[model samples]
Target: MINQLRVKQRDEYYSLEVESGSNLLDVLRRENYFIETPCGGRGVCGKCRVTVNGQTALACQTVIDRDMLVELQNEEKTDILMTGISVQGVLDGTHLYVMAFDIGTTTIVGYLMNGISGELLTQVSSLNPQKAYGADVISRIQYAITTDAEELRKMICGTLLELLNEAAKSVKIKTDEIALVSIVGNTAMHHLLLGIDVKSLITPPYMPKVYEAVELAMQKLFSEHTEGVVRILPNIAGFVGADTVGCLVATRFDHLKKMTLLIDIGTNGEMVLGNWQRRIACSTAAGPAFEGANIQCGMRGQKGAIDHVEVQDGKLVFHVIGGGVAKGFCGSGLLDLVASLLQIGEIDGSGRLMNGKEYRLSDTDVYLTQKDVREVQLAKAAIRAGIELLTKKIGISISKIEKVYLAGAFGNYMNPKSACLIGMIPICLLDRIEGIGNAAGEGAKLCALSKTEYEYSKILASETEFLELASLTEFQDVFVDSLKFTEENDEYL
Candidate 1:
C-alpha cells in the first residue's frame, strides 16, 4: 500500500509518496530535514517528537499506517562552538589553499585557509550524518559489526564533500582549487573516515589499528572532489586519537613546565596530566549524558532547549536557547539544574531527589527524574574518577596542579561553578580552571598552516603515555567513591 505523506515546517511544505509503514523520522531525514535522534531511534530519549494530524507523537515510534499530515516541531539553530585560541605565526606552505577538518562524533567543522598566508577564508559545519546509526562511538561500532561499515564511511565522506563544496562556494573558489587537507578525530571517527575496520577498537586491549599519522590521496576518500592529499594526525590510543593530539598541539602541552591538566569533556572524556617532566593521558567512558543522551528529558544544545537553570528569588528559572518555551534540558542546563537542586537541599549527597521522583521545571513540561539523577552520577563519576586516577598515576596531588584547561564545546558553555558544585570537577581547582574553546579545531588549523607544527603533533602523540583505566586495580573503588554528590573534600584528592 502507498500513503501520501504531507510534511509541514514553519512556512514550507514537502510532499512525498511513501510506503504505508515507513518511519516518519527516516522519511524526514531522507528529505534532508533536521531532526536529532541521539538514541539511534530506540524511542528511549523522547527527543524525536512531531505532530501527526494534530496529535503529538514520537517520530521514531510513529509509523505511517495511513495517509497523514505531519508537522515537524520547529527546530532551533544548533550553536556549534567553532572559534578557538588564535594560532599565531603561520609558516608558508606550498599549496595555494588548504582545508583542515575536526571530525567530531557529533559535529564536523571544516576551515578553508590560504595556505601561504594562513588567513581564514571560510568555515562550515554539519552534524555528523552517521548520527542516525548511533550517538556514541560504541553504538556505531556495534552497528558496523552487525550491519555494513561501508554505510558509515559513505555517509561521512559525503558530508565531507558537502562541507568542502559549501566552503569553496562561500570563498568564491572551486573545490578543485584546494591543494591539501588535514584531518583530526577520535579513533573511531578516524577509522570511519578512512574506512578502516573498527573491530580492534572495541576489544580487550582497546587499541586502534593505526596510531601513527597517515596520508591518503584525496581521490581515495572523495571521487573527483580535488587532486590533493589528505593528512591525518596521529592517534594516541583507541579512545584518544588525533583530536586530542590536536588539542595538545594547539595548547603546547608538551612544553608546559607547570603541572597542568587538560580535559576535553564530552561523550568520551579524554584528559592529560603533567607537562614537560611527565605526561599521562587517559580516555574515560563518560557516555553521552553530557551531550544530552540517555537522560529522561535530555537533548543536545539546540533551539528551545533549556541551556541554563537557576534558583532566582526562591523560584526556579530557566534560560531557553532561543528565548522560547522550554522543550528539553541540554547538558549544561542539566548540570546547572542538578547543582542548584543540591545547593537548595532538594537533592541529597547520594544524588537522590528529596521531595519527589522528579523535579518539574516551573512553567514548563520539562523535568528531571530520579533516573536522570543517576545518569548524571554515572557520567560525572566516570570523568571525576578519570581525573583522580590520572593524578594518582602521575603521583601528584590534585592541589599541586597549577592550571586546569577545559576544552571542547561542553567545557566552554557549561558554568564552571555548577561543575564544581556537582563534583564533576574538583572544587579545589575551581580557581585555576580556564576554558580553551575548540582546542582541537585550533590545532587542526595550526597543522594546516605549518609543516613544523604538523610534525610536532606526531612527537606529542609518541611522548604522551596512555593509561588504561579499566585495567587499573583501584579504579572500581575510586569510581564508586566518586559517584557521590558530596561537598569537595581535601581527603578525596
Candidate 2:
C-alpha cells in the first residue's frame, strides 16, 4: 500500500507518494529535502522536527502509515564563514578557469576563479548535506562504516556539483569551462568523498588509506562533469587532513621563521605549533561542544540561537543571532556564557554550578546545565592539553609564540578572552592571536591558482610531525588539570 504525503515548507507545498510504513526521514531525504539528523536518524539529536497532520513530531521517529500532511521546518540562512586571507601566488594559467573547495564537516564552500588572472569570479557555500547523517566526523564515519558509504559519497558529490554549477551560473559561464579543481578537507571527509572505507579510520591504528595528494579526472567522481582534473590536497594524518595542510599553505607556515601557532577549533580540534623549523601537529577529539552539539540546550549557529553573551552591569546580556526569543546556545554564545558565569562566581573552577544542577539564562527559557559545563570542560581541556603538550615538546613556553592564527568558524567567532579565561587557549598568547577566516578555503584557492603552492602543500603534509596525544602518559594529567577554569591574567579587559 502507498500513502500520499504532502510536505509544506516556507508556504510552498510539495506533494509525493510514499510506501506504507516508510520512515518519514528516509522518504524526505530520498525526495531531496535537506533534513538535519545529527544522530543519523536515531532520534537522539531531536533535530529532525516536522509537522505531521497538524501535530509537531520528530521526522526521524515518524512512520508514514497513512496519508498525511508533513510540514518541514524552514531552514534558516546560517552565517557561514567564507572570507579568508588571500595569499599571493603566480597563476600558471594551465586552464581557462579553475575552482577550489573546502569540504568542512558542517559547511561546504567553493570558489570559482579566473584561470588566467587568478581572479575570484564567484563563491558559494552550503551546509554539508551529510549532516543529515551526523553532525560530527566520528558519527559520520560510523555511519559510513556500518551503513552505506556510497550514499554519503553521492550526497557530497551531488552537492559539490551543484555548488560548482551555482558558481559558474553566477559568473555567467558553464561549469565545463573550468579546467582544473582543487579540494581540501579533513581525512574522514576526504576518504568518504573518495568512497574509501572509514573502518580503519575509527579503529586502533587510525589512518587513512590514502594520505598522499591525488589527481584524477573530474568525470571519475562525477560522470556529469568531465571537463577537468580534480586535485585533492594531501592529508597529514588521520585527523589532521588536507584542511590543516591547506591552512599551512595559506599562512606559509613552513616558510615562517618566527615561532607561530595555528589552531582550527571545530568538532575536532586540530592545532600546529612552531614554525618552518619544526612544526608539531596534533588533533584533539574536542567533540561537537563547540558546534553546540551534545548539550542539554544546544544548537548550531542559527537564528534564534544565542551566539554571544557578556556581563553588563553585573547582569548577563546575550545577543541572539536573529534577534528574537532565545532558543538555545550556540558554540560562541556557550563559551561566552560559561566565561561570564565563571567571572560572576556562578560556576567554579572545577566546572560546578553554585545554584543548582541547571542555571537558566536571564529572561530566557534556555538553561545551561551541569552536564553542559562538563561537555565544555572536556572540549576545552582537549584543546588546551594539545596546546600545552605541543609547546612543551617543542621546548618553548607559550609566551615564546609570536603569532597565533585561528582558523575555522568557531575559532574565528569565539571570544578570545573567554577562550583564555577557560584555559582553552593560553592567556599569554592572547595578545598575538588573529582570526584568519576560512584559512583552509584560502589554501584551496591558493592551490587551485598556483602550481607552486599546490606542490608546496605536498611538502607540508609530509614534513609536519603528527603527535598522538593518547600515546603520551602526561596527556591525561594535563588534560585533567586544564579542565579547571583558571584566570591566568587580569590584563584581558
Candidate 3:
C-alpha cells in the first residue's frame, strides 16, 4: 500500500498519496504546494530543504516510505512590483492602452497595460519565430547574412502581431486601441526587425548601423495593421542593445551606489556591471543549451517538458510540467538533471556520462550522453567567461561585487546552487543573486505606462559603455579555460 503525506497550509490540509519510492518534492508540487524549487524539483539548490522530523532533508532527494507530516517554509519576498492597469477600465476610459514587448531569443512576452495608471491588464507569451532558424542570436544573425533579410523581418513582425492580437483578444480590446507600443530586443534581433543588414554583427569589428533611440509610428512600419506609435528601444553598442537598457531602467540601477551586475541568460547572455560612476555592458554568444535547444530531444519550457529531475538512493526520479507525459527537456530540467547526476557521482567534474549506468527516465528512452555535457560546458563557459571578462575590464574583483540580478525567463527557473555547481556563476555572488523575471518586459511595461521610464530608457542608451567580447584577448582564454569543468577548486566556479 502507498503511504500518504499530509501538508498543512493556512487553514487548509492537503493529503498526497505517495508510492514508497516517490520524492517529497514531486508529491508536494503535484499537490499544488508553493514550494520554492527554482531548479524545478532538483535537490541541488538546497532551497527546497524541508524539516523532516525536526531534521532538514532535501525534499527532492528524500523518498516517502511511510506517512509523513510536512510543513512548507515561507519564501522571501522579491522586490518586483506586480501592479498593472485594468483592460476594461482602459478600454472604457480616455486613457491610452499601451503594449510592451520583450522579444527574447527563446520566448516572446507581451504586456498590456493602461498608459496612465501603470496597471497590468494582461500578459501573453509565445515561442520566438526565429527559433525555427536557430535558438541563438548568433545563428539568426548568420542566417540573415546568407538568407533574405526581408523574410526574417516579416517573420519576426508577424510573430509580434500575433502576440499583440492574442493579448488584445484575451482582454476584448481592438488593436487600434493600443496607443503606444515599445519593444526591447538584442542587437541582432533589433537589426533584423528594422530590415537592416546584420552581416556586420556576424564578423569581426562588429558595428551596428544605429545605436541611438529610434521612434517610428507602428502604422509606418506595419502599415497594413495598426496605427499606434512604435518606439524601438535604443542600442548601447554592437552587442548590448536596447534590451540591456530596458533592464537597467527596470532595475533602477542608476540610483544605486554599490557596484551591480545585471546578467540576462538566454541565447545571447548579456551582462551590465557598474555603479553610479559608470556602467559597462557586453554580450556573449552562450548558445541555446539553457533554452533546451541543440540537445537531443530538447524542447521549450512548455507543457509536457520534463521540468525537474532527482536521484533517490541511486535511482532516477523526474517530473514533467503540466502533469503530463514528458516529451523533452527544458532549461530548468537540464540544470536539475545535470546537478542530480553530479551529486550522485554519476558524472565527474568534466560532465561525462558514466559508462554502464542503468539509471533512465520512465517517460523517455533518452539518457544523458557525453555530447550533451560538452554542449552544457560550452554554454557555461561562455557565460562565466563573459562575467569574468567584464569584472576584470572594470578593474574590480569578484569580491567587490554588491548585487547580482539575474534577468530572463530561464533566470526565474534557475537554482543558484546548480548554477554555481556547474561553474556558470561565481560562488561568492550566489547569496547576493536574485531572480528578476523578464526585466526587459518589465522595462517595456514601465515605459508603456510612464513617460519618465520611456525617457529614462533613452538616457540609459546614451550613457552605457558597450564592450565587445570578441576584442578582448582575455575573453578568449577565459572562455576556453571555462569550457573544461576540471577546475574544481576555482572560487568563482
Candidate 4:
C-alpha cells in the first residue's frame, strides 16, 4: 500500500495517497495547491522553499516519504497590473457585457466592459495561479506534460471563474450575462488554458498545434457550467502567441507609416519589427528576471517590494510599493537599481557589484547580490540582443526605428530611462519608447467589441513573419556583448 502524504497549504490541509517515490511538488500540484515554484521544480530556483515538519526543503527536490507534513511558504501577494484599459467608441445597450483578458505568465488581467456604451465597467487582475508550477513558459509546458495538462487548465479556468464572479458582483450583474471573452497570452499559456496538446510547443521548431484564431463556447471549457464564448486571438507563430498579435493590434502596428517596434517583455521577450509595409516578429527566452523571479532577493510587483531606485547626492534612494520598508526587489526597481548602480560604478561592465558578494540597498533588510546581477545580466542580454537582432533583420539602423511601443504592465511600470541606461534597450531608442499598459487586454477588448477588428487580427497574424532567434548566426555574438552594462561597450548599438 502506498503511503499517504499530508500537505498543509495556507489554512487548508489535504490528505492524499501518493506513489511511494513521487515528487512532493507533483503531489501538491495534483491537489490544486499553488505553491510558488519559479524554477519549474527543477530544484535550481530556490523559490519553491517549503517546510517539512518545520524543516526548510525544496518541494521539487524532496520526495514523498513516510508521509511528511509539508507547510508551503508564505507567498508574496502579487501586485497585479490593472490600468491602461480604455473603452472607446460607443456601446450598444442591447449587446451583452464582454470581458477581455491578457493571460500573462506571471499575472492575469481582465477587463469587464459595457458592450453597449463601450465603457469599461470593471477591471480585475490576479496572479496566474499556475505560477505555482513554474515562472516561465518552458517550465509550465514541462509541468503540463509531466503532471496533468488538465490540472493546468483547471487552475486558469478556476482563476477566470473567480475573477468573473468578482467582476459580476462588483457591478451587481450575473456571470452568465457575459456575452464574449477574448484572450491573449503567450503560446504556452494559450495552449495550457485550452487543454490543447502542448507537446509540439516543447518539441523542436515549437510550432503551435494550430495557427488560427480559436473560438470555443464557455460551456465547452466549463462543460455546461458556464455561458458565453471564449475567443482566443490568432498567434503569429509557435512562440509568438496571440499576445504579440494583440499587442500589434493595440499599438496600431499595421497603420504606422514609420518603422515601429512593439516589445512585450515578460518571462518571454516578444517583439514585432515592422511598418505599414512590412512586419516581422520573434520570441526570446528572456527568463523571469525582468519580472523579479529567478533572483535570490527578487519578487513580483507587490506591497513591500521595492519598485524604483535612484541616486541622490551620491546616496541610494529607493521607493517601495505600498511603502513601509523594502522586502525585496520588483522588476522596475531592479531595473532602476541596476541602472543607477551601473551609472555610479557600483557594478562593473560585467555586472559585478563592487561591494563584494552582496551589496546592501539601504538600511532596510534589502540587498542585491552577485547571483542577482547574473540573473539581470542574462535577462537584459536576451532582451537587448533580441532587439538588436530584430533591428538587423529589418535592415534598419537603430536610430531609424521611429517608435518603440513598450507593451505589458512591466513596460508601463519600468522607467524607460533606466531601461536604456542599463542597456536593456539601445540608448538611441530611449526617446522613442512608449509604454502601452495592458495593451494585450485592450486589444482583446477591441476584438470582443468589433467583428471588423477581430478579422483584422487574423490579417495581422498572417502578415507577421516569425523570426527564429536561434537560427541567426550573429545572435550568439551579440548576446555575449550585450551582457556588458558598462559604458566601455558604448558601441553595443
Query: What lDDT would each prediction earn against the true structure?
Result: 0.88, 0.90, 0.74, 0.83
At residue 152, what lDDT does model 4 achieve? 86
Model 2: per-residue lDDT, tens digit, 99-202?
A: 99999999999999997888899899999999988889998999898888999999899999999899989989888988889999999999999998888878
Q: Is candidate 3 or candidate 4 better by lDDT?
A: 4
The alpha-carbon deviation from the true structure for residue 117 of candidate 2, after best TM-score superposition, in angstroms, is 1.2
Evaluate model 1: give its lDDT.
Answer: 0.88
Reference-based TM-score of each model: 0.95, 0.95, 0.77, 0.91
Q: Best-fitting candidate, measured by lDDT?
A: 2
Candidate 4 local lDDT, 1-493, one digit each (tens) = 4877777767778777877888888787777677778887778878778898879999889877766888875566776766653535323354569888888998889889888767789989888988887888888888789878998898898888888778888999988888788888888889898889899986888799977999989887655346678888998877899988887777677888988988888888888989999999998888889787878788878888899899888778989888787888889999888888876789988888897898887688888889988988888889889888988888988889998988887898999988888888888788898887878887888887776777888999999888888888988999999998847335531
- Listed per candidate, the RMSD to the true structure in angstroms reads 2.3, 1.9, 14.2, 3.0
The TM-score that candidate 2 achieves is: 0.95
Candidate no. 3 TM-score: 0.77
Clashing pairs in 3: 84-119, 84-120, 85-119, 85-120
| Candidate scoring better on TM-score of 3 and 4 | 4
lDDT by residue (53-110, candidate 1, tens digit) is 9999988898999988899877667788898877684576688789999999999999
Candidate 2 Cα errors over 4 Å, as ranges? 1-4, 15-17, 53-56, 65-68, 487-493
User: Global lDDT for candidate 4?
Assistant: 0.83
Candidate 1 residue 291 Cα shift, in angstroms, is 1.4
| Error of model 3, residue 72, in angstroms | 42
Superposed on all Cα atoms, model 3 deviates from the true structure by an RMSD in Å of 14.2
- Candidate 3: regions farther than 4 A off: 1-95, 311-315, 356-359, 362-364, 486-493
